[model samples]
Target: MEFSNTREFARSMDKEDPLATYKDEFIFPEVNNKKVIYFTGNSLGLQPKSAKKYVDEVMDDWANLAVEGHFYAEKPWWDYHERFSEKLAKVVGAKPPEITVMNTLTVNLHLLMVSFYRPDAKRYKIICEEKAFPSDQYMIASQVKFHGFNPEDAVVEVKKRAGENHFRTEDILKKIEEIGDECALVLFGGVNYYSGQVLDMETITRAGHEIGAKVGWDLAHAVGNIELKLHEWNVDFAAWCSYKYMNSGPGNASGCFINEKYHELKEIPRFEGWWGHSKERRFLMEPEFQPEPDAHAWQISNAPILALAPYLASLDMFEKVGMPALIEKRNKIVAYLEFVLHQIDEEVESDFEIITPSNQNERGTQLSVFLHGEGKELFNYLMKNGVIIDWREPNVIRLAPAPFYCSYEDMYEFGQILKRGILKI
Candidate 1:
């Protein structure tokens, strides 16, 4: 794995990669007819070559079968949502019945919150990370406001020490203990979008339950990129968007999960719709809602077959590769990227830091680079040079070398581009 320089090492790794063939499965972006180094999968993944064909099937059903597509199409659009569950369950480590393809990520979060975030006067506070994704923050604030409470008083945000860039597990555990008695819920991103820090879900779940608080996860960045054990970890509920690592296209259908323990808990209130009704009685046009005995109970409307098709295709690919194998390969490639970045000399190192955790277990496929000066300028230079990493506001750039499409050569080329970009800054 040693490289004479970034270039030599990247070339050598690309030659030996067992998954090297996968790079060709995607349609790489071309600017002026040259393929760019694409490291922005954390933002939006490149399209799979087969995605159009996969989507075309659904389009065919819609065009030819129309409303009858619900039951008569080749894939039977009636059960199209079901087609994606098994494969997605494999990726997220959930039982098939415990998962469902449903609303978009933020919408699913709000739905789960409506069922889980029941705040009483004595335990009305919610605990979350300080820099949670904006959608999550907004959802929590709105939920608290809906419950007739001010977010300033009802939401307790956990933060790292002022000088520290990453969250420490000890600090998170301590904060949970400090607020446990008053907290009604603990919802956090499995892997933070900005810092790329992967929280210890098992430990956090246990701590929240011990304090009698419900716990959930926003897994938009974690799914497909990291291994999950939602059932074993006793996560009450979780939701994720599939547009990023899942390669399901922009603003695609999302998935939801509920722990099996909740299936029989009739006392827990839920937001109900006809889609969540038990299939046997759903056609009966019954007025009272009898939910499908598992996670599908959260669905609010009929499945979007076209949107679900892309997710099904993406999940099929994940099922073929298996999460453990994908993660193992991702670790090596990301580590290689880190090795190159660290070699960029003392001056460059002084100007930036890798805010993502150093331990492979503490992150997914992303590395969040924090720049000390001229952040936008550096980002613009890299983009203009055809190195497509994404820039977050203020001072950071997120580069994710996804296992499905990115190669070691892309990482090496990025290193060269980054070095040249910084010199101009």
Candidate 2:
């Protein structure tokens, strides 16, 4: 397809888009009295118009029925979280019994580690990517320290080659083999938050298992943005925030995946509570803790109905638009965005380097551009002119054109705005 930098070309592309009507489903932010071209769905998704109704239902239930709403509301507050399992299982490629919605992202990771990260003195080290998201860095370090191990000795970071912005899979696998006997856990972000690089999870998980290590993924940036087969990948466990690409509101409930094999394990180490107990006898208030034979066994408390409401609303959208449709548009829009960036770079005589992987399979919706010979002023210029984007340090901007709402014309408009800004400023 020959690409053009014209509105007509963009419009023609949008007209042919099967997901074009999805843009109307979201409520966008306005800048200078017009809707801003949003590019931060990788950070926080735009709210679905249906989110209000979901929240309102819960609010009305609480207001009218009070405590009785727990078992009597339209959706039934007690079973609200269960509604997410079937739909979310489809989203992440897991069985309904293998999935659950529970605490926030990092908190879920902490809870899951309680069961998976049991390390002996000889096999005590955890392997993760270098410069992982700071929250993960903190979580792993704190967990290591809690286990009486110095993070310096117990945490192995797989580093990228010098002068390279992205990590090579060979480097990652080699690191695992190098730490073979000492590696106790292998956890990495499925999609790197900074680079938008999709790590090879299935291969990495296989390597980790062969070395007698537990493997998991932090899918915060990957869950809704990329295709995942957690159960088939044989991932022992995984967790993700719903707010990013899931459009479940800010800091909403997170989803979890626990392979079904662990559910029947009688000797597994888990942090259990009444909510994780067998539902048949959970309300009996007995002294014994009989765990649910699935992912819900990891839950420490009951569901947060208020927070989970918006998530269920977004999951409804996912059910309507399956991952196949989402990924199709994701590849198209991201490539079109790259084309526009290169075309603009040529016109402006600017050296723009995209650090995100160019291979479709290795990258998601984000393109992290290093604006050589440009500065934060260009980023500011873009923000003040109705283009919403994320700015990282050292003059890099993350442009994540989420497939559900962002249009091709938005990309063209952004290019024009960028050209004017570059020429003027």
Candidate 3:
């Protein structure tokens, strides 16, 4: 289907967009004296207008109530974490107890690994994507080394067949079948950070269970961008950071999920902390660790209200718009971007292809563009011209038009800037 390459066409789309009013809710960045056409929600989302008020509430509580603010503040600092779980659960399609907001991404990954990566002599290997986010790779390598296992032997890196940019779901299932017996954990990103491919989580989880392996997802790029049924998917555990499509601020809070089935299991080893203790007996200061029955049992420290507040605000917005509606809008906007980009690429016979699958169900809001020439320079040029997408090294550029705020006009503006940027090269 051909799309009109005219400003009037873009205006018409924007006029009919049900969520267009939400554009006013964000604080967009400006580059070189112009409002940036931000297509990088996959990297860092635009801040919500309410983010300031949320932070201010916490600051006000701290300033006025001192340490006693934990139980007495307007939002009640001690129960601050609880305030977010219900809304967050709705966004991710899990029950409240199955989720908890806490720590940075890699930190939570390590904590979850400690509990889930229990390997015996017969089953001691971990399977992950080959070009996973660098931090995930490092965390896995270090965790394996800490267990006295050489990463080269203990970690299995899965990749696409030769000449392919992304891995096929069939290949992943086959690999799981081949190595299931020896695999202790299958830790995969729900949507790959570089490839932007949304794996079949339900199918992947079922395959892992068939092999007696624990299935986990790192949802850093997938959380708000895609619809997830972590509980129904029977995911053993999952972790996500909220700074991306969730539209929470930079370095904002992260969340984790553990299926209710595992919540009752006493033998599942975990790294215990005071926060993970049962709420009824937590203040008793007992020497024994009595863990909570759900994902809260994974918490290691007191809640960070300053960082978490923005997510609460964003999650409320998500609840208002609803995931199904958000995803439907995202599909149309992304399709437009892809269609426009393909038009220009065809004009020049450019050596570029979108590595993210064309199937709507196989991706979220992001499109990973692979460029044939030196990709970094083109990315830099786009940046200088105020097209705010992000670059993943070695030749890929990722663009995500977050549904809540980005508009059809934003996409058109981006196309104009990108086209000019390419022609200059």
- My TM-score estimates for the predictions, one after another, are 0.97, 0.99, 0.96
**Model 1 stretches with alpha carbons more than 4 Å out:** 346-350
**Candidate 2 lDDT by residue in tens digits, 1-425:** 78888999999999999999999999999999999999999999999999999999999999999999989999987778889889998889999999999989999999999999998989999999999999999999999999999999999999989999998999989999999989999999999988899999999999999999999999999989999999898999999999999999999888999999999985798888889988888889999888888888887798999899888888899999999999999999999999999999999998999999999999999999998888999999999999999999877899999999999999999999999999998
Residue-level lDDT of model 3, residues 1-425, one tens digit each, is: 45776788888999989999999999888898888888888888999999889989999989999998988999987768887778888888899999998898899999988888988888989999998889999999999889888899999988889998778889889989989699999999999888788989999899999999999999999898899999888898899999998988898888888888888876678888888888788889999988888788887788988888898888889988999899889999999988878877876667788999998988889999988874788898998888887887778898889999889988888778777777888
- Return the TM-score for candidate 3, rounded to 2 decimals: 0.96
Could you say which candidate leads in TM-score?
A: 2
Q: Count the backbone clashes (under 3 Å) in each candidate.
A: 0, 0, 0
Q: Which parts of model 3 have CA positions greater than 4 angstroms off?
A: none
lDDT accuracy of residue 305 in candidate 2: 92
Q: lDDT: which candidate is best?
A: 2
lDDT score for residue 146 of model 2: 98
lDDT winner, 2 or 3 = 2
